[model samples]
Structure formats: C-alpha cells, structure tokens
Target: MQTKINKVELRNLEFDDYKELKNSMVESYPEMVGSYWREHHIEKLLSIFPEGQLVILVDGKVVGSALSLIVNENLVDKNHNYSDITGKYTFSTHNPKGDVLYGIDIFIHPNYRGLRLGRRLYDARKELCEQLNLKAIVFAGRIPNYGQHAATLTPKVYIEKVKRKELHDSVLSFQLSNDFHVIRVMKNYLEGDTDSKEFAVLLEWNNIYYDESPKLINLEKSVIRLGLVQWQMRQLNNLEALFEQCEFFVDVVSGYGSDFALFPELFAAPLMADYNHLSEADAIRELAKHSEPIRKRFQELAISYNINIITGSMPYLEKGTLYNVGFLCKRDGTSEMYSKIHVTPNEVQHWGMTGGSKIRTFDTDCGKIGIMICYDVEFPELSRLMADEGMNILFVPFLTDTQNAYTRVKHCAQARAIENECYVAIAGCVGNLPKVNNMDIQYAQSAVFTPSDFAFPSNGIKAEATTNTEMTLIVDVDLDLLKELHEHGSVRILKDRRKDLYEIKKINT
Candidate 1:
C-alpha cells in the first residue's frame, strides 16, 4: 500500500464542485436528499458572492464547506426562519450593502469530522466579515440533536444546558466553543429537518476590529486594572490571622474593581514564624506544608472577593526536593501554580530550594499573563518566552532583603517591560521577621511598569508604592496601548527579531 499524504487547505467553492458538495451534505442529513442544495443553488451563490462560499479541500478533494451571504439586518426581523432568510430558495435576501454576514449552510463528510475544519471555515467567514466592515456574523444555527431530549427538555432549556457545557449538540456545541453566542431560540427554522425538530438558534460573532467611525484602536476587552499589595512582615499568632490580612487587601482591591490582586513573594512567611525554632531548612519545609491550605483559602477569597490573586511565592515540597512557587487564584475558582524557574544561591543554600522545570503563559479573565518569582524576573529569556505566548502582563513577586537586591529586580523587570512590549507589575515583602532566619530583613517598592514609549509614562513606571511600605498600588494598564506599540513603536524587537539567524523553541521534557 502506498503511503498517502494528507494535505488540507481552504478555497472558495467553485461551480464545478457542486456534485461532491451535495454528496457530502447528504452524508450528514440523508433524510433530505432532493431537498438539499443543488447545482443551480451553488452556481447562484457563486455568482452573487464567491468569497463567502468556502470549502475545505483535503488531498485535493472537497470534504467540508461553510456557506454564507450578506443580509441587511435592519430589513430582516429577528423572528425570520431559514426559508425566509434564504429568500424561499431564491436567496433574494442577499444584500451587497448589508450590516451582517448571514450564514446559511455548513456540512462536513463523516470521514473528515473532528479535524476542526468547521472552525477553519468559520474563521474564514469571520475574516471576510471583518474585511467587509460588517457589524457581525449572524446565523440561524440548527440544534439537530434537540429531538433526543425534546420529550423532557424545552428548546430554551436545552440550549442553556449546551451553553453551560452540561449537554452537547453536534452543531451548536461546536459553534458555542468558537465564540458564537445564542441570541435566542429560533423555531420552524427548516422544513422536514427531523433531527433539529424544527428548532434552531440565532447565533452571532461580532467583529471587534470593525470600523464604524475612525478610531485609534478598537477592542472590547482590553484594560486590566491591577492592585499590587506591598505586604508587610508582621507577627501573626496563627494561620487564620495571615489569611484575614490577605482577605482584607483582596476586599479593598475588589472594591475598586481591579482585575488582579497581587501579594509579595513569601508574604505568608509570617506564618512560618511558628516554626522558627526548627532548622532553617526544616522551617522552609514547614512553610511548604501551609501552601496547600493557603492556596485553598486564597481561591475562596478570589471567588468571594471577585478578584484574581497572585499568592506571591512560597516553598513547595515535591517528592524529596523543595521548589519556590506561586499560586494564581483566578476569580473563576481555579488555581494555577508557577514555580520559580531560577532559584537564588541563598535559597538553595538555606532552604534546599531547587529551580522548577516548566513554564507557560497563563490565561486569565482579564488577558494572558505570566508569573515569574523573585529571581526569575532577572533572567531575560523567561519573559521573552512569555512574550512569545502573547502575554499581556508579567507579575513578579520578589523578596529581596537588601536595597541593592530590590533594585536588581526592579531594573531588570522594567527592562523586560520595554523589550517584551508588555506590562510588568512587581510586589514584594517589606519590613522584617525578627525570629525567622534568612528572612530577617526585606525591602520592596511595589510598582507597575509599562513599555517605554510616547503612549506610556515617561519613566515607564505607571505607579509605585512608598519604599518598604505596606500598601496596595492600584493602576489601570491599557492593554490596547501594548497592541499599538507592538506594531508601531520606537523599537519593535519582537517583530524585528532575526529569525533567519536564530530562533527560540521550548524543549519538551
């Protein structure tokens, strides 16, 4: 048997490909044989708007298709059905001067399903919708599997379940996953569509970059207000006290509607004052014991306060070795850990801390972010790796005991913001722990940084806390500005990288 190479590409559906298109359509909806689209229908659509007729070709053979046509949203009512929108099979509803792209048909062959070809087709439609300056991509999406649950569930309830991920519809599920939302449940959408039971969903995917009026930039989700907590070293009698103080700051940050609430690296070290009598290494391990419970409580605080909390950095014990790690507790009740990629000499000597092995970008409700603990921010490679992953902000939680040490983290982090063209926020422990060894003294001036350009602050420091003071510095950083700077800035290091001479790739472990 000869080895067959599978090559997949997308192109406009041509009139000559009508036979294979009908064949693939029937493979999914066999009950509607003659009722499906015919050669004349394909020729008519191609003649009217050829770019909207997209087909996926695998090994030079058409396997799937996404069909769409422009429609004036003002002329059509929201209650319109499939036949009415398709102009009684004549497609008279297609308007060249329209505000929306009305999706009419989509189908895939059984052998080519699950390859995400539908997403590619949807993307092509979205690109065309944006390029044509359309307001949105509107479609009547079929709930074909609604018949299975119609005996007990209503169409509205079924759609709700699908949106909540409690239920799945072959078509609607895929659409919802691709950012399309249900405007409402549509009825009598198609004739003799048994699987759908004559029900459909009015779905829409808005184009963010659509130009209604001349503007500098257009983005719905951009600005992320952050609150950096410059935590103090205090005498806490128990673990609850530490949590209470942390919760208070979270409350304040959340009250101001900040997207992120960050604490200092080892800010919870005050809890380790209880184990001060143990050896330095043993005490760090004891601090590791509190990591699990604190992560849990911070997660609760994140949900209750409705703020994302970076729990700074703490000692993490795995197997027999110890590592420094931070927990990013998102308001959605999920916790992610970012271990320090590079451990300091003092940490290795005193706490038996080893560097972590994995690093990846974090997806938050606000935007893509990354966490690099104290010493990790000093290395340029880590932040560059994060920038490659489209990181909008980088959080550095440090615990430098000397003013020089603090300056090292501060200067390098600022450099990262300039070079990566992303925001950088740093918070660290202030004051001192009288009892805890190797953690006796600390210094930090929590600050938020921005790319050094005309759009940003002159010094690139958005806001900064008073030196070694326990306070939260609240600042709103415009992610839209970063997008603008990435393209047209004084220096474009990311785009100007000499990829022909060098490249950076992550090695899989």
Candidate 2:
C-alpha cells in the first residue's frame, strides 16, 4: 500500500489540516488505536502554540506531522514521569514562559514510510527551536520491537543492547540517528501500549547555538561608536615624535568612550622625514622598513586604550614588493591587514605600488565590516560585493591632495552607502607637509554617512568635520536600526537588486 510522493511541501499546521492530521496519525500508528489524537485536540494545540506544530504535504495531501510544546525545566526535573510532564496525554503542562521545547508526537503516513519524511520533520523542529532560542528538545520515544524481548530481558538491558548495536528498535534507532541521546528508560510512560511492555525511552536533543545572554535590543546601547581623526600632515623631526602624535589622538578619543578610532590614509607620511635625503620612491621604501614596528605600536595602543584602531594606510613591503596596506588593530591585541585594491596612477607611477586583487571583509564583535581605501570606493562593484557578504559598515581612508580629488572620494562614498544600504565612514589626511615630498599640500574633509531614506537623517550625513581641519569627529551607529531599515525601508535597494538580469561576479585568478 506504499504511495510514491511526487511533490512534497512542508508548512505550519493550520486549522484546515486537522482532519488530515488525524487520519495520518491513525494510519501511521495503528497499534495505538485509542491513543490517536482527536481533531479538537489538534485545534487546541494549534490555537495555543501554533509555531510548534508543522505538517508535511505530498501533492496537496497531508502525509506527516510533528507537534511540540514549550515547558519549564523546573517543572519536569531529571526524575519526572511522562504522564506528569504532558498531563495525561492532553499537554496541559504547556508553558509560554518555558525555555525548553517538549516534543509531544510526530507521525508519518504508513504509505509514505522510508521516504525520509520523518527526517525533514525533525529538521524543521530543530530550526524552530533555534528561532525561539529554546534550550533543548525532550521526548519519550517508544521502542515498539522491545516487546518481543520483554519476556526474557528488562527494559534497561534491551536499551543497552540497542545502544551497543546488537539489537535494533524501529523508533529508538531512528531517533538515535537524528542526534537524540537516551537519558534513561521510563516505566508506565504510555499505558496500555504493546511497545516496550508499556515502557518508553527518555531522549533529548540539546540546542548548542542557544545564547543565554540577553540580546542587544536598545538602539542607543547597541550602537557602535567611532571616533574619526582627520590627521594633519606636518614636518616630523623623528619617528618618536610621530608616534607621540598618534598616541595623543588615541588618548583623546579613548576618553570619549569610543569603541573604535579611525585615521586617514598615509597619515604616517611625516615619519618618512628621517629618509628625506633619499629620493621620493626611496623614502617610501624606507618607511616600509619600519612597517613591523609601526604595526606593533598600533597593536599596543589598541590594547592600552581598550579601543579598536584603523591605522589608515602604511607602505608595506613584502617579498621584495611594496603595497599601500591598512591595518585594523582589534582591542584584543589582534590585527588584520587589507591592501589597497585600486592603486591610483600616482601610486603605481611614483611609488612603485600595485593594486590588490582580492576584496575581503572583516568579522568583528560589533558587526561585519569592509575597508576600501580612497580610490577603491569609486568602483561600484567592489562595495556591492562586500554588501552581499553581510557587511553593514564600510570604512574608507583617503589622502587626497586637491579639492577635486577629495570630492571624487566623498561622492562615491555617499553613492555606495545608498546603493548598498550600509554605513560609510570616510577619514582623510589634511594640512600641508612642506618638507615632505609627495605628501605636501593636502586637502580633505572627513564624514560619517548613512543611507538616503526616511529612517536616516535628511542630509544622510551623521557627522562631518570642517574642510582641511585637524579634528576628530565622533558618531554612533545603530546596527539593529540598520537591519530594520534594510528589511522595511522606503525603498528596498538590497532586495530590489536584479540578480537575474545582471550580477557582479568575482573571477578567480
């Protein structure tokens, strides 16, 4: 009487499926004739806890069902019996304030047996447990075939045999394969049952992903505050002086309770003063030699101030090649480096630096973030790819020497914020370095930008600094609000992106 199902759909149990559920239960568990759930019982369970009820439909016909209820663990301790936990098969012990999920029953039609339908139902229950943040799922599984050995062996001995793989019970074997471990055997779990001589196996599946800590819900409290310093370029007498200047900014920003502080690209150019006797290209090469010490100092500052620092851009030399790389020093004394992906003509022709090929995003405790140096943000495809990878914030560090160069970076940064629906923070180097070559006559303005919508500020600017000024602008960004706007905004740009018509695919080299 087996029926081959062509199409299968899984959905939450509705009132209209009560009759089908009753029929399916009866057909699936014929041994429990009087134990079959009535239609009214199904309706009552759905009305009270609909999220825990689910059904599997095969070509518009109900073929399987899984039902669960929430319960407090304190009420059902380690030694509690099944009848007391579920209230005599009526689920009167269901608790809305419970942290654990209690599995009441699951059945698939006899004709649809061996189709892996039961596995799908179990997976759905696991997913529901995660969404509700439940602690674990507990159930009493019947060992139907244990009745045959009841005359010679006790329930404990039978379960041991099954665990050792010397014996197989239909229900216990299936549950074990699905990651449910047996706690112990329960006597008189189901009255008048032929299975296990009226005994059942207590099983549980723990939710490993459950977080006991409270979630970040308050917008203000959940905000990640950033202090952006538009560093002023100047003549430096020595490396010690340059380090002292950097520490001054960090000390000031740390007092304001900022979680992260950002600096401009090539802000360390003044450190190249020690090598001014060499050519412009040789000077950058000399700066690259101090990359290790520079990174070590940034890491120490990050740990000392208890703040994450973005060390703008440094001339990094590796394997006989020079690169314009930015370093992110985390508060935990760790760091990550991102090489500039789009090198400007000045970088390639004058500094002998090449562009990086790979685009990457960093995973932090606050949120997922991406770093694109100056010219990189101008390319729309790069930011879009990063947004696709769940980046909520994009940091741009620039070192523009002219108003026109600064405008190009600023406009493209704003456009990226709109197209990707993400926060964009731009910081640049300012002031004039008269004695330093290729670093003099800087023009810059730093800003924190947001998406253009009703939920955001009217001007889309969270905070901005005065043009060509040496200042640090602090701003707080709400990650939860960003998520809400992405889903229910005035215009859903991330959702409306036409992937079918066109997509920005990264070609692996």
Candidate 3:
C-alpha cells in the first residue's frame, strides 16, 4: 500500500480525545477489542495517560497508541503474567526488587499495512518505553493457528500456554526480529473470563537503558510558627468583675513567651437573666464598657509580650446591630477585627445576635491567619474557605457546655487542621456561665492542633480553665511543621480531598 508522508512532531494530548481514540480502536478491532469492554479499557487508559503520551501518528494523523502506568505491585505468585489480559506490562515487587511496567497496544488500519507499519508503530511504542525508563515491555498477541479452528480452543488450553510460553517461536518470530525475546509465560490468574479466548507469552528486553536529563534541585522553603486561641468568655454579673478578670488573664498571658493567644466565643458578655434583668440596650452598654478595657488589655499583652493575641469573640455593637467579633492584636498594640460570618440559631433566637456577611483573613508577618467565632467552626465551609485563601492558622473562639463538648470540639479542630493543612487553636470557656433555662452554662475543652498532631495529650485536653474561672494557657506552635506535612506526608488530608467526588458549598451568611 502507498501512503502520503507528512511531518511528525511530539506534543501533549488533550483528555477530550478519549471518545475519539475509543471510536478509532473499536472501529478497527471489532473482533479482538469489543465495544462492550472498550469503555472499561478506555477509562483505564484515560486515567493512565491523562496527558496522552502513548500516541501514534500516520500522515500527521493519530493512528495508533498504547497506555501504561508506573505502579508498585508484587507479582507474588511468581507464575503471574500481566501482559495477557490485564495489559499491565510493568510492575515492582518489594522482596526481589521491582520494575517499572510499560504496557501498550498498537492497532493499524486494514488498508495501510504493506509499508511494514506494524514494526514502525512498535518502534514508536518502544520510544515511549525508553522515555519512561521502563524495565520491560510486555504484551499478548493472537496465537498462531495450531491446526485447529480459533473457535475450537478451550480456555484451559489458553491458560496453559500462557503459563508455559509454548508459543515462543511465533511470539519471538516477530518480537525477536525487533530485538525482543520471550522471557516467560505466566497464567492470567486475575483475568477472569477475559483470558478465555487465547493464551499469551510475556517478553523482556534486558540491558537496555535510556538517558535522562539532569534535574536541578530547588529545596528552598519558608516556615512560620503560628498559634490560635479560641473559646474565651468574659461573663460576670458585674461588668467591673469581668474587666478585672480579663485584665488579670491578660497580665498572666503576657508573662508567658507565647507568640499568640486565642480566647473563645463571646469573649465579653453581661449577665442576662431570663432576658428581663438585661434589656437589649443594657447589653450593648455592657459590651461597650467591656470593649475598650478588653481591647486595651489585649493590646498591652501583645505589645508587652511581643506576641500576637487573638482576643477571641466579643460582641461588637455595629450600627443598631450586634456582631460577634474577633481581633488580632499585634505587638505594637494595634488590632485588626474580623466579624463572625456565620451565626447559629441560638445566637439569632436567644442572644438576638446577627451574623456577619463576609469572610476575612488576616495578613500576618508570619503568614495569613483566619478568624471565626463559635458557631462558625461548626460549618466546615468557614474553615475550608479560610484554608483556600492560604490561611495557615484558624483562630476559633468557642463557648459550649454540651456533654463531651471538648471531645467534639477537639475532633472538629483536628479535622479542620488536617483537612486544610492549617493550625487550629481553640480557646474555650471552662467555668460556668449564668444559668440558662434551668441548665448551667457550658464550655468546650480548649487546645491547639496541627494537621495530624495535637499539641495536647490524646485525652483531648489542650488546656482547660474552670467555668466562670480565671486562667490563661499559652502554647507554642511551629508553622513549618504544617509545610513539612504538605510536602512529604503520604496521608495528605488536604491535597487528597476530592472536591470532584463531593459537592462543596459555603454558607457565608
């Protein structure tokens, strides 16, 4: 057959060509490759050759191709051949060393064969094997006629020949002519009914090495240590007592060499008895009085200790409304505030507090930090959005008295930390708050957590203070550890999260 010749160049292939490649293969090999199983094999090929490296060109058009992947799998049986039905040409077994597999199947149009195109296509696939630095190239082809009709062959006979390399002569006839040799024949134990049609022989070419270009190593990285404090509540029947206690805790936290300290939800609150003792107006007044003192004390703490302190969640009276606010206190006594973007029904119904409308991440000298209050942590999107914004630390201030509150808190904190590759710090109210409906007020266990590790013991206790008690717990964190986990850890909780497999939506308001 005569054919036109055109320039051939190698380039990256698009994934959308899957259907086209399938159509081409099925159209040419209806007998050997059927339409029913073509989808399965094509899907496998798409996954393996996402960039379409296994391709062939004839007259500047794609005509033939092969699919392969480099994986670590043990040929444990010592009698297994992947080349036959599995189409797995390469594998590595840990015990006796391993090999990178190269698998490819080449198909030619019936009208274009007289030009020795089969060897040309095989040569093209060989180039791919060399490019991948594969150990061996293995495949199975039709068995030569054995004086019996192809339909007369039994599955047992096919399996037996596949295990014995009985067709080495015919296989080597074509392969050996191209510097290939029959190394062994192994049974397709995992092939199921697919291998019932014919037997196959495995082939290998030894001592063939390909040269690779040298790569320059770029190991430069930046590391920052971060800390989050959450769940700090300052509620006292007397505004005077609340400020006094907050001032004291600030002084004590300053005494420690903490880079950052976080306080929990509603860091400042006034006593509300059955919603009668304190009206809406009185609540705002108390919050205002506590705000300046609380802000000043945290400012002093941050400046004096040369650290950053997240003052946790406080009620910020904004225009005729109230917002749960978090602050980042800097060493210079300056502070940045982020209002809570999500509020629970309890806040809207019980506290008459509305949620904030936007997400805000702080740009710190160390790295970006995200701040959200109690109810916000319950919503995965808040933390996930912060993580997507490149925040390395999530500061959560929480207030809860639920049973196993701390355990639940710790679980969520650790999960967010691992999933976002960020640090989560929780500051919680441990002591009792004013009586609520006939139940005593609640608090969550407080702690600092990294991606896979917690700074506190496994008992889920990072640190705790008595409810309605006065205390400060300062813990140090290493941001570099988070970066390390992202770079080297196999359990990449954050990177491994499959958004395509799950629906992800954020509830901002």
Instruction: Write down the worst ten-residue block by lDDT for model 1.
Output: 213-222
Measured over all alpha carbons after superposition, the RMSD of each candidate to the real structure, in angstroms, is 17.0, 13.2, 18.5
Question: Positional deviation of 487 in candidate 3, in angstroms?
Answer: 1.8
At residue 269, candidate 3 shows an lDDT of 49
> How well is each residue in 129-244 modelled by candidate 2, as lDDT tens digits?
87888888888888999989999999999998888889999889899878788888888877777766778898888775566775677212448898899999987777778889
Task: Give the better candidate number (1 or 3) by TM-score.
Answer: 1
Clashing residue pairs, backbone N/CA/C < 3 A, model 1: none
Which 10-residue span in candidate 3 carries the lowest summed lDDT?
89-98
- Compared with the true structure, all predictions reach lDDT values of 0.88, 0.87, 0.57
Candidate that would win on TM-score: 2
User: lDDT at 251 for candidate 3?
Assistant: 56
Of 1 and 2, the candidate ranking higher by lDDT:
1
Ranking by lDDT: 1, 2, 3
Error of 1 at 134 (Å): 6.0
